[model samples]
Target: MKIRTRLSLLFTLITAIILLLFATAIYYSAAKDREKEFYSLLKKEAYTKANLFFDADITQKTLQDIYKNNRKILNEVEVAIYDTRSNLLYHDAVDIDMVKETPEMLQSIHEKGEISFYQGDWQVIGVRYPFQNEYYLITATAYDEYGYTKLNNLLNSSILIFILAILVIFFTGIYFSKKTFDPVRDMIKKAKIISASRLDLRLPLKDNKDELAELTNTFNEMLTRLENSFEAQKLFVSNTSHELRTPLTRLLTELELSEKKQLTNDEYASLIHNLTTDVQQLIRLSNSLLDLARANYDRSKITFKTVRIDEILLDARHQVQKLNPQYKVNICFDMETEDDSDISIEGNEYLLQVAFANLFENGCKFSDNLQSQVVITNKEKKIQLTFSDSGIGISEKDLKKIFDPFFRGDNKYFTEGNGIGLSLTKKIIEIHNGSITAQSELNHGTTFIIELPI
Candidate 1:
């Protein structure tokens, strides 16, 4: 069943049960009150008859007349009077005795003074009366027609009201439940209209601070991340195609030119050297792209271990020097104590090495001295490393876009390097829960600072 219908039914069922119990209680209480009132009237009639029978001023005819007049007030009312010896003295009916006078009954009435009970449908009350030095027993019985009629009418009315109340509660539940889920319905409608081409669209937020509003906010935040990721993917594909096409085009042109002309050994060797350089450039670009893609993997799936930051730097330096022997990397310690734990951090060792290698290469590639200096420090429960190089520094405008993939500064056009290094380096550092930032000035060189939790 739909939520609205289920809620409505549940609401009606609960209200109906409560109404049933309440109506039953009211009817039972009213029936009890009516029975008590009828019994009271019977007891009063019995006492009056006994008193009048023993009165010396009232004659027998006058007593009968008084009883006949009062009997008309009660329905099916019967009165009987008896002496201590169980002899019937006065009977309300002329031709028959409605109540049987027994010795045990008179004895009971004398002992208890008064008692009330039911005889068939009649309410009976027996009373013990005292006249001059003698006790008499008097019993009266009556059927309360008016009381029963009123009780029956009340029961029927209560049933009718109970059914009406249940109906009201059922519809009221449906109305309120629909009102409550109206926002969710609107969200579903809006979401249906949003596709990849329309990622900029967002769900409208209400002014209230409720659960539905929080849900809308969370969805909007997710949409923002998805839009950013899509844009980044498009940019990455565009940049990759452009970077790859340059080296491939150069290689193709070189091969075409050599095939078209008869060249000397020196020309062939120079052409071969140029082709090798282009091939190497392509290989490096491909490796950098792979590293960048790997860095974007989910962190939870990656295995991390406690690896020393300084060791990663040393390994990166060795790798850089092995590839380009002319490049010089100097590592320095600026802290007071060289504690192993202080320099150790939880991270994927290979990714950390890649990040450091990129930074080292970047520092040396831009510097005139073909060298970079890396200083390590342990402070505030974190490992801080600074890579400094005395290069023909970056302009302020270029520095801002340095970490953007394939973004080379206008001043560094003469350098033979792809701009993937810094961007890949930043992604790797972030994967290890670390941060890297660069500071540079024109002709004053650049310094990259990295901080990682230990």
Candidate 2:
């Protein structure tokens, strides 16, 4: 069943049970009150009859006449009086015995001041009266016809009201439940219409601060991330295509020219050399692209270990120098620390090395002295590293786009690079829960600062 229907049924069932129990209690209390009131009336009638029967001013005939006259007022009432010896003394109704009089019954009445009991549908009351040094037993019995009729009417009315209330509650529950989930229904409809092309669309927000509003906010945030990722993926593909086409087109053109011409051996050798250079450029671009893609992967899929940041930096410096022997890298500690963990961080060693290597290569390749200087500092549970070079620095406008993929600045002519290094470095650092920022002025060179939690 749908949630609305199920909630409605559950709500109705619970209310119905409570109403049933309450109605039953009210009915039971009313019945008990009626029985108690009727018994009191019977007891009063019996005592009055006894007083009239033993009165010194009234004769026996007159007492009988009074009872006969009051017979219609007390409906179906029977009264009897007996001496202590169990001998009948007076009886208002001689034709019908509403209650059976026994010696045990008289003895009970004498022991107790008064007693009340039931005989079939009749309510019976027994009283002990003292007159002229002798005690008499008086018993009265009557049926509460009016009270029973009223009780039956109340039970029927209660059942009718209970059924009506249950129906009203069932429908009311449905109405309220529908009202509550209307916003959710609208949200689902809006979400269905939001395709990849329409990522800018957002769910409507309500004024009240509720869970549904919070859910909408979370969904909008997720959509924002997805939209950014899609845009990045598109840009990456376009750049990769453009970068690969240049080298491939040059290789194809050179090969075609060599095939169409009758060249000297030296010309052929130079042509081959040129082709080799183009192929090597293609290989480097492909590798950078692969590294960038790898860096964008979820961190959970990457292997992480406790590796020293200082060790990774040293390794990166060595690798850069091995590739370009003219490049010089100097590494030094800003502050001495006895704790080994001060320079240690939890990260993927390979990715960290890749990021550091890019920074080192950029620093040396862009500097006029062909050198990079790295300073490491450990403070506040973080490892901070600065890579500074005295090179033709980036302009203010170009610095902002340094980490963008395929974004080469005005210094592009000063060095041969695919422009993927800084972008890939940024992704790798982010994956390791680190931050990288650059500060530079034209002619003053540039410095890249990185912080990683230890």
Candidate 3:
């Protein structure tokens, strides 16, 4: 079902339940009041008879007739007189069960010399009156026969009322639901229309500031992200095709010519090395791009454990030194203590080490023209690693694109990079709830700073 219909049904159901409770309370309350009034009337008449019955002159027939016929005109009430021996003295028409004064029944009698009792189908009110003579009077009225005959008729008529009320509430709910879901439905429909091809179109936003307004705002944000992702994917495909075509074309040309022309062993080795290097760079670029894509999704199973930041930094430094022995690579351990107690962090030790290594290696590659220096500082709240290079620094415009996937600087053609180094670094930092940034000046050095929460 549509959201509008479901919401309407929900609202209508809730309102109906509340109405049912209210109607039940009112119906029961009216029935009790009617029963109480009748019981009171019978009690008064019985007390009058006790005075006239003339226990002082029990031989009088006139008082007995008056007592027997008293309150007989009250069609809904049943009056009974009890003697001192707990026997039924006299009674008028009785429809429902007459309450008898057993020890349990007497225990329930109220302070007002009356008792009120209810079983689901019957409500009874009984009042007891005492006389100076050797007799007691009891009066009772059944709510079932009195008001409930008319009440049952009224309740049956309310069946029609219940149907009408439900119809009215259901229609009202549907009308409001339509009004509420109109703009949102429109936005969703528009969203379904747009894809990577039609990203320029945006959904309409309503003016109202209710929940629907917030919904439209959220939808707009989603569209913005989709548009950005679409653009990035397009750019990445274009860059990848362009980068891959160069090496493949060269490899093809070299192979074709080598078959046609005689070549020395050294020349053949040089060609093979160049081809291998290009292939390796392409593979690195592909892997980095995959990592970048994967990082955007949930990492719920990315388990973490206690890993020393200094060890991770040292590993990355040692690996970079092994790769480029030409440049001076220096790493110093400035830990407060070598014990795990003094320096510590919680993360996957392997991934954390890879991230540090990527940053350090990238610095070393860019600094192949000069000395490369790196420093890692472990603080109480977090760990900060700074990798500085003496090679060409990033220009003002290229600074922002440093972390963007496949973003290569204009002046760094001599250096080697797949352009996803900083991108992967940023994603790793984000996973650890950390941050990474780049600071560089032209002709001077570039320094990359990373901070990770402990």
Candidate 4:
């Protein structure tokens, strides 16, 4: 069942139970009070009869006539009196023998002073009556016909009210439940029309400062993130396709030309060398593309361990120096801490090394003197590494997009690169939960700063 239906049924069931308990309590109290009142009236009638017969010197026939004339018609009261010897002295009913007063019954009334109990539909009250130094027992019984009729009517009315209350509670519960979940229904309807092409569509917020509004805002944020990711993926694919097509097209054209003619030895050797250069460029581009992809892939694929950022920088420096011996790469630790672990951070060692290598190579490649300076500082739970060089610094417009895939500054047109190094480096740093930033001015120098938590 739906939650709304369940809630409605539960509400109705609980209301019914409460109404039943209330009706039962009211009916019981009314019945008890009516019985007490009837018993009081019956006791008064018994006392009046005793006074008339014994104290007033009135005959039993005249007293019976007065009782029959003055008694309430609905209060079918009957009275009996007995002496201490259990001999009946007075009775006003034809069935007085049916209500036998045993010696135990009279002794009970004498001992307790007064007693009352139910005898089928009749309520009986017995009392000790003493007159002229003689002990007597008086018993009265009556049926509350009017009170019972009121009780039956109350019972029928209560049942009707209970049923009506249950129905009201059920429908009210359903109406409120639907009204409460109306936002969810609207969200579902809006979400159905949204596809990848319609990512710009956003769910409306109620601004009610409630959970439903919170849910709507959260879904809108998720859609925004998904849209950004989709756009980035599209851009990455487009750039990769363009970068790969250039080299592939060259390779195919050169191979087709070579197959069309047989040439002299020198010409053939030159053609082979040119083709080899293009093939090497393709290889480099392919490797760079793979690195970019690996850097941006799911972080779960990368293994993590505690690694010293200083040591990783040293390793990257050595690798860069080996690849370009003419370029100068220097490193230093610029912190007061003697503990080596202070400079340590958790990350994939190889990926960190690759990121630092790209930054170092970029510094060396762009500098006029092919020289770069490296500084490392360790602080509380963080390490700051800076790479500075006297290079052809980036322009303001190009610097903003320097880390974008396949983006190269205008001044670096002659540089031999696929332009994915900085992009891959950025992705790797981000994957390690670190940040990289750059400060540069055209023709002055460039500096790359990296921050990582230990």
Candidate 5:
């Protein structure tokens, strides 16, 4: 069953149970009041007969006259008088029904002094008086107290009415349930139509400030983000193919022209050298793409070998100095702990070297070769490598895109770059679970900062 249906049914069941209890209480209360009224009438009739006997004017003629005067109301009742010896004194026994004149009941009446009730096809309450040494039996007919057959019939009819009410309530509850849940169903249907293949489709939102409307808005926002990412991916692919193809086409054309024409040895050598440089740059581009793709997929497992932070920095500094002898390189080590500590991490060694190499290369490329410098700082849990140069600095906007694949910040310095070096470097650091950032002043200098966990 649906949730709303079950909720309605539960509500109805609770209401019905309460109603049934209330009906039973009311029925009994009405029955009790009716029974009291019947007994009151019987008592009143018994006292009247006692008054007649006390007045000593209860003659057969007077009794008959009094009975005729109240016959309309008293015909449904019975009046009887008896002696202490069980002998009837003044009673019209033939007028009473035979079913009500049972011998066992009569015996109890005699023993109990006054009859409270007399059983028959109809309900009656009886009372007795002991005035003037006489026994009196006064009974009044009552429908609420004794009419068992009629009571049973009324009960069956009431049960049928209750059952019919429940059925009506059940269908009404189901209808209300469906009506309430219709909007939610509509939202689900609309959501089914909006997917990656149909990003233009938007979910309909209502003006109401409810959770469903908020959900619709959130879904729309998610779809918008996915569409933007997909568009960026397409543009990236197109740009990358064009950039790589230009050099490849030029190399192929140059080799073909050289082969078809006679050329001097120096000319041929120059063509071969140019072709080799293009091939090497293409190979580097491919490798950088592979590295970036690997970063997108997974990082390497940590192999925590105890490494000296000072040694790593010194080695990087030496490598940079050898690459650019005209520039000055400075290394600083701040050892906050004793030796043999785990001043190392479980990481891919080769990836870390690539990151350091990128920082050094960026410094060389951007530095004016006079004040070019790289600083290495180390402590307990982290190492910070800074490379500062007095060359041209990056613009604020270009700083963010420098690490993007095939991104170029300098058109002049990029004469030898396929623009994948810094992208590969960032990917390598990320694989080592580290960070690299750039801070630069336009005219004075540029700085590259790297932080890696030990």
Candidate 6:
């Protein structure tokens, strides 16, 4: 069953039980009051009969006539009188088979003064009356027909009221349940219209600061992240295709030219050398692309530990020099503290090395096979590394796009790179909660600065 239906039914059931209890209490109280009133009337009649029977001047016929005239009657009323020896003295003018009083009951009434109880459907009351200095027993019995009818009517009315109350409670529960879940329904409806092509769409949020509003806010954040990821994937695919197409096109053109004409041994050798260069260039581009992809992995999935920043720098400088033996990378440390423990940070060692290696390679590559200087400084739990290169530097406009994938500067047309190294380095730094910035003057020099928290 739906939650609304279940809630409604539960509400109705609970209300019905309470109503039943209330009705029962009311009905029982009314019945008790009716019984009390009937007993009072029977006792009144018995008293009147006792007064007339004890009057010395009244004859038996006169007593009966006075009793017939002065006594107020009730339905199914019956009265009996007994002498001190338990002999029958007076009987009421009742046509029904009256309930008999036992000697044991009269003995109890004599001792207790008065007693009332039920004899089957008849209500019986026994009283001790003193007349002429002798004790007499007066007993009355009756079935309260009017009170029974009233009780029956009350029971029927209570059942009707109980049913009506349950119906009201059930519908009220349903109405409120629908109102409570209306926001969820709206969210589902709006979510159905949202797709990849419509990622800019957002769910409506109320200012009520309730749970539903919180859910809507969370969904909107998720949509924003998905849109950013989609845009990044599109840019990556476009740049990779463009960068791969260039080297492949060059190789195909050179091969086609050689096939169309015969050439001398030196010309053939030159063509072969050019072909080998193109292949090697393609290999370098592929490796750089792979590194860029690997850098995008979530940092949580990679192994992390405390590592010394100075060791990473030394290792990166060694690797860069190994690749390009003629390039000089000078490292210098500038610290105010003698303790090297302050220079340690938590990170994946391999990825941190890759970021530093990219920066060193960029400095050496841009400085025209000349020397590059790397200076490290420590300040307030942070490490700052600066790479200074003296070569053809970047233009002011191209500097802004330098960290973008496949974005080479306008002044570095002859540089041997696919321009993915700096972007990959920037991504790695960001994942480690660090920052990288650059300052350059065309044909003068370029310097890259990196700051990492220790």
The lDDT leader among the candidates is 2
- Runs of candidate 6 with Cα error greater than 4 angstroms are 1-166, 176-186, 204-208, 336-341, 390-400, 411-414, 439-447
After TM-score superposition, the amount by which residue 73's alpha carbon in candidate 6 deviates from its true location, in angstroms, is 7.8
TM-score of 2: 0.82
TM-scores for all candidates? Answer: 0.79, 0.82, 0.75, 0.83, 0.56, 0.67
Error of 6 at 224 (Å): 2.4
Per-residue lDDT tens digits for candidate 5, residues 1-454, read 8788797899789868976887688667756665666667766765666566456666855674566566555343445554445455554333643234445555666667556654543455455556656565443343333444445666677678778887888788878878877777887798788776777777787897888788878987888888876775776687679778988998989989997999999998999898987887778667666655655554434443555555665676676567557646565544455644535655555555555655666666666664555565664466676777776778788878887766787544634565666777777677666788888876667787777787
Q: What is the per-residue lDDT of model 6 for residues 1-454, given as tens digits with 9 covering 90 to 100? A: 9877898898889888888898999999998998899889889877876786776556666655554554456464567788767787876553443667678888888899999999887788888999868999999887887889999999999889888888888888899988987888898899999998998888998897988888899999999999888877888899889888988999999999999999899999999999998998899889888888888888787777899988998898898888788878888987656676778888878888888888787777777767888888986678888888888888899999999887887755657788788899999889889999999998888999988898
Count of residue pairs whose backbone atoms collide, per candidate: 0, 0, 0, 0, 1, 0
Per-residue lDDT of candidate 3, residues 1-454 (tens digit): 9988998899888988887777778778876676666556656655555554435455335554543465454344444555544565655432333554464454344235676666454445555665653335364544345566777776776667777898899999999888877777787788799887887787777787888778778877888888898898898788778777877788888888888998899989988997887788778767666766666556687778888777777776676677666656666554555567445777767667667777667666666464676676776667777778876778999998888877888755857676776787788888888888889998677888878886
What is the full ranking by TM-score, best candidate first?
Answer: 4, 2, 1, 3, 6, 5
Candidates' lDDT values, in order?
A: 0.87, 0.90, 0.69, 0.84, 0.65, 0.84
On a 0 to 1 TM-score scale, where does candidate 4 land against the true structure?
Answer: 0.83
Task: Tell me the RMSD of model 2 versus the true structure.
Answer: 3.8
Kindly give the stretch of ten consecutive residues in candidate 1 with the minimal lDDT sum: 93-102
Which residue pairs in candidate 6 collide?
A: none
Which has the better lDDT: candidate 2, or candidate 4?
Answer: 2
Count clashing pairs, candidate 3.
0
- Ten contiguous residues minimizing lDDT sum, candidate 6: 65-74
Instruction: Give the best candidate by TM-score.
Output: 4
Give residue 149's lDDT in candidate 5 (0 to 100): 48
- Residue 370 lDDT, candidate 1, scale 0-100: 89
Off by over 4 Å in 4: 1-58, 61-72, 82-88, 94-105, 129-136, 176-182, 263-303, 319-327
Residue 262 C-alpha lDDT in model 4? 85
Relative to the true structure, candidate 6 has a C-alpha RMSD (angstroms) of 6.1
